[model samples]
Target: MDPQHHDYTADPHLHASHPVEENKPSVWKKLGGGSLSISIIVHAILLAVGVVWIFQIIPATEQKVDFMPKGGGGGSPGVKEVSNKKQRATMTNPNTPRMAAKGVASTFTLPEPDAASSMSSVGSLSSGGLSGGLGGSGSGGGRGDGHGTGFGSGTGPGLGGGAGTMSPFGMVNPNANAMIGVFFDTKQDPKRKPTDMTPEKLRDVIKEFTNQGWNERSLENKYYKADQKLYQTRVYMPVMSANEAPKAFNCEKEVQPSRWLVIYRGDVVAPKSGKFRFVGAGDDVLAVRFNKKNIFDHGYTQGTTALYVPGKVDVLAGKKEDREVERIIRGGAMRVPVTLYKYDTTANWNNALGGVAVGPEFDVTAGSTYPIEILISEIPGGLFGAALMIQEEGATYQKASTGSPILPLFRTDGSLPDAKGKDNAPPFDSQGAVWKISPTSRRDI
Candidate 1:
């Protein structure tokens, strides 16, 4: 048979019969092609696949990932890895202390305890007026005694029975042990001082605390006495939870009274003098009175009240202003703060009663009237012995009523327990004398 004629492709069955039996040779050699060249070609194809995977496929897959969560889905998995790397880099930066953000909260250092003592020493060294060392005054009422709950309560004047000795209308003595500070508006003009009080100067100062029921005659009049005075001294307005008055006279049985301070502004003749009094409308005046137990007892009840000038005055001709400041005067307490709302007709006074207004019921059947209101500020003790009101105006507006000398009311010892107890003590000395507070001094460190 010719080698070309006996073709391997044409005679599959005949070729099988003449099988080559070289089983001992390597498997690669058994094949027709050289083993080295075939192996090289296979390696080249694998290398190309690896290069595409590392350089092209991996980077392209990384760019297509979505790291952050979107539309609240299951969340992206692969993108989070790259985000974590960035966060780590930011945390390790040395130039930034924590996060280099300007809006970070700051820490404040507490003043050393010695700083307070040093300030006290400096106050003692000053030449200004000094308040003598008078013990505090205390007002106490006990509830639930041998008689019954809220029954048989006995209340004494002052904390240590000192109120009886001090006149309600009298000014607290300047040399008393208690400390007092007064700030009044007297310098309505730039070229004046508050202490430089002439008749006109005093009028200006009075108007600062109260812009109702003020007049030139009232300012100059010495005979107005305490009744005609717009703001009474040492008065508090209190509101009771219920209408039932405190039955006991003791410190505990007595509760807060529902009361308010009504102020009127404008000129009126002195109660003693029938003269026109050269009074102007729109005068500053504070109206303060106790409920039920005379104008002296500062008890109050929680109810709606209106404070306004009942009488009509010319609005353009210096119309007088009237205000109603609410306060709560509980037994054993000192001062009360009243709110003076700006005159408004559209305001809902009904909503404001319990929410904003703190005083007792004052009849205001007439609708849409302007009034001032004040809330009660609780200060322990019956009287603030060291009370001062320095008249100042123009330089500083006398927005607060407690700082006026004419007001007679003052803040008591700052630390006062809500209810009387063993810790309770008087704000002034046991003698029930007048007091003056040491002047305040400021130094920049």
Candidate 2:
């Protein structure tokens, strides 16, 4: 312990035996070796954890919806309807005979079948255009009975009331005038045409179809639970009954204009201050509403129903013409003697169904918006269309080939659909004349 004073030269034996223990392998070296081993072990553990964390699979987190579902909390208190809706197919203005609302001839007579030919074959060729030989439609539609799904009476182009081209888009309206169109599959609704188009029937049908509670004020219904509930601006679908709307408008699940209804309701802005009337027609039903009042109520099936409100309905109801109208509408598949009515006369149009009809004149303040509800319905199927036009007092228009003055189509905007030929051209003259809508219509979309 007290070796500081004892010199190594003085004690040679002790010094030789010990020899400073070969520098005692540095303390720093020992510490460094131990630290390096600990560092490696710690790093290895951290790396393994990192690798496991990175490579491990994590499940997708599910989103939760917290709310009560239809039919209340329990199952099956009431029946829930599940509708299979489809998207629209491609759109093209194919030649469809069903769109012959404005055919060239005011009169159409079915040609007597060539007994010698079609009886043996022809399976009722139904191609809509000129594709058939002595039958069927043209435009690439194959030979008879071979045109796909169903059979129909053999007829040719320019025949069977072949008026002119009844284009799908006969009128154009602006987005402001556009209304929300709600389509209803009324096959389950027991009520017939005119009634089915009514608000009462709509409520009943919706109540039966939906589990949701309904009230008179609500336009909402189970039918609104649709993906295709798009806005409709123009009322120029003359060939809607011709199996075109479902394809033309790209409305998927809704085929066949029959057993169906579409109600269009929205605010219409007045373009000017004047006495104006809505003029046009529908195959089955077309009812217009302004300020909760029925402005125009005319359709094919309207004649079939009892006259509930006489004065409010077709102004010419009690006359002899209505009886004829009832007969024609109730009659099966006849296209002629289509409905034509004015605010004054039913004598000119004995059969009231598909031609132009005028509503009573109403006053509107310039630029003021008014609520409007329009309904187009089909009860009995086959060949459907509706034309809506507007006319101001003393407004003269281009005369159609039928010699009727072509009125401007009722529209909010100047935009229109690219319909084919004379626009079906219609009693309203969507083609010969401009499709000018209410210029004073308020533009508050």
lDDT of 1 by residue, 1-445 (tens): 8886767767888888886878487776777558678888999999999997888745432223222222111123333344665444432331221212244344522222221111000111111111111111112222211111111111222111122212211122321222211211222222222333343433333323233322324332322111212111231221212111111111112223111112221111111211110000011122222211111111112111212222211111123332223221222111133222221220222123211111222322222121222212111213111111111122233222322112112222121112122111111111211212212321100
Every model: Cα RMSD to truth: 25.5, 21.0
Worst 10 residues of 2 by lDDT: 86-95
Give the total clashing residue pairs for model 1: 79
TM-score of each: 0.18, 0.45
lDDT of 2 by residue, 1-445 (tens): 5867777777779777874645567877877987898999999999999988877766554342222122111113121231222101100111212112333343433222222222211321123321221222322122223222112112332111112121232111123334555555544222222323443454334323222221222433223222243345567663534444333333434344455666666666676777877777665566676655556655444422322222323434333345654553333211223234442212222244324656667888776768776767555566676667777877777665555666777754444443444223354444422222233543221
Q: Top model by TM-score, which number?
A: 2
> What's the distance in Å from true for residue 25, model 1?
99
lDDT of 1 at 116: 12
